[model samples]
Target: MLNIADTLHRWCREERPFALATVVKVRGSAPLPVGTSVAVDEDGNAVGSISGGCVEGAVYELCRQVLDDRGAPQRARFGYSDDDAFAVGLTCGGELDVLVQRVDPGTRPYLATALADVVEGRPAAVAQVVEGPEELLGGMLCVDAAGGIRHGPLTGVLRREVGAQAWSLLRAGRTARAEVGGDAETCPERLSVLVHVHASRPRMLIFGAVDFAAALSQAGRFLGYQVTVCDARPVFATAARFPHADEIVVDWPHRYLEQAEVDTRTAVCVLTHDAKFDIPLLRLALGLPVGYVGAMGSRRTHDERLRLLSEAGVPEGQLARLRSPIGLDLGARTPEETAISITAEIVSRTNRATGLPLSALAGPIHAGTSS
Candidate 1:
């Protein structure tokens, strides 16, 4: 499958006409979650994003003109680091780069197919940006869930194998990078693939629409989760309350879990303190392949919940999957702080980490650069 970059290239070649936006660099806290992308078509149409509505407008204009000129791919950059952003009228003041190119239909047939596949739920594609002009720009592999590697302008058996590994990652809804070992004596530098895994955007199913849930949804969005909030009361589940949430469902907690698709990449968090809502939801959450299942309460509440579940025929082994007292022991007192603790726990699970502080631990936080 064609990675996002290659897909744009291929589409442009086909004369379909699209824009390409890329995160070139990030500094400080950063507005855009890096690797965020946005594109536009010839008729001032767009898909994806570069920043939080900051530079996307100007970038789209460039794309509109660039689509008409298929001479060569052009790279456009915007950033807070530059004095130029004020002139462009970007409020967020974040840094971004956009590549506007006309795609080749014949050469990028695979990319076009991959783009279609993603929209149709054929699974994501992994792509490798190898031998590019700069450091972060080169040898980069972006793997979709299925692990198919999209290697650009690079060829050989290694490319095939690595691309296949990328494909596997894409299909699996995981991200990974592969480095080719064998190289000729003349070519000393082994192919170093900077693997960037793009799984299906994680689903954050939040079971409460309380104040805490808003912060929790924001935290989840920061982690790239497609956030959703559930509250049986329609009054609470309004767009005004959860501005960050991608979705808000007013339905029974357990029913929502049963009806909505839950997968391994999904996370379910129960913020409601009420036993009436949480217990049923917990039962449903434990049954799925979801990566994380957490419920908010105290140690006493946790014990009581366990006792109730035991009475309901849930075994101890199954009950162990529930994070009853929910969140790491971060000594968080407020809803926002508590939200951070919960999200931290989710990251621990995602990275398969032990949830220890860097001061207490040693070695790299990231497990491997390429896998």
Candidate 2:
């Protein structure tokens, strides 16, 4: 899987054979969503995880069976029951549908390419036929951001249809299952494919090389974001100050944001707390369709900033998108705590969460719109 891209690349370079077990479908309170995978080598070495540790042992055995049999990929389902709490079921009372397939250096050459693209931060997607004819089981199709099929097995109408579906999922940064072929009423044996989007790391643009920026950069990296720290002052925006940041740009915040590539997954954190930078930069950020746009400041500063933004012709709706005071009400007093608060707010916003404690929630802790 893309999560273990580095390890997968190493295995490919070493010509090592491995079995990949992917969670293609999940139900109930599953810990991981579809597309999460774990790889086990012939030597019993493992990388990644499909479950949080509940069904891993059984999945590992399934991986070994795939390598030993050298046959068509197999699917296994694991779930929790009232009587099977201590068995191979998830402690969280969830269910998982796992697909185990052996991958060899000679047979799956596209895997190496996919792993490389993931490591290099390129957008890609892996489309696998999880349910189909025995011979087609585990068959793979790979596509990149440019609508190019790096490798695949389908052809003609089927290929085009599947590629279009994969491209759509890739752009949305979502993993999902798609059905192809004739209508159920007219024909049977419809193909079921899982499109696993390997999107590049989401961007986190932190405008201001302050202490909070340094901590936020580290937190962003930990959360798998490509963090950029920007400031107009060259002395403040140095690599030494924000080592975890992917880039340190010494430029005006508004100018840089105008030229930066931001998507629905991107998060912008305005930590400069200066009117000159915050006013102009926020005007642009609020108008863009980014995932999050938060500015750090006190209550008084927030009111002043809003007044200036309103006077600058920013629409009321766009101004409402700004999360002034930046983070959640965690009563954070230190840079590290503030960074955690900010990242937590970003996560909550992106996931459409209520920012409530798990204990207070009645449903699954990781609940979200299923894909």
Model number with the top TM-score: 2
Best candidate per lDDT, number?
Answer: 2
- Tens-digit lDDT track of model 2 for 1-371: 67688898899878899999988877778877888899999999999988888888899999999999988799999988797557788888777888999888667787678777877878888888888777777888888878787666676667777888889889888788988766544224678899988887799999999999999999999999999999999989999999999999999999999999999999999999999999999999999989999999999999999999999999999988999899999999999999999999999999899998888889766667243
Encode model 1's per-residue lDDT on 241-349: one tens digit a residue: 9999999999999988998977777889998878899878887788778889999988999899988878877777779889868899999989899999999998888
TM-score of each: 0.60, 0.89
TM-score of 2: 0.89
Candidate 2, residue 3: the lDDT equals 68
- Candidate 2 lDDT: 0.88
Off by over 4 Å in 1: 1-109, 112-123, 127-167, 177-197
The lDDT per prediction is 0.67, 0.88
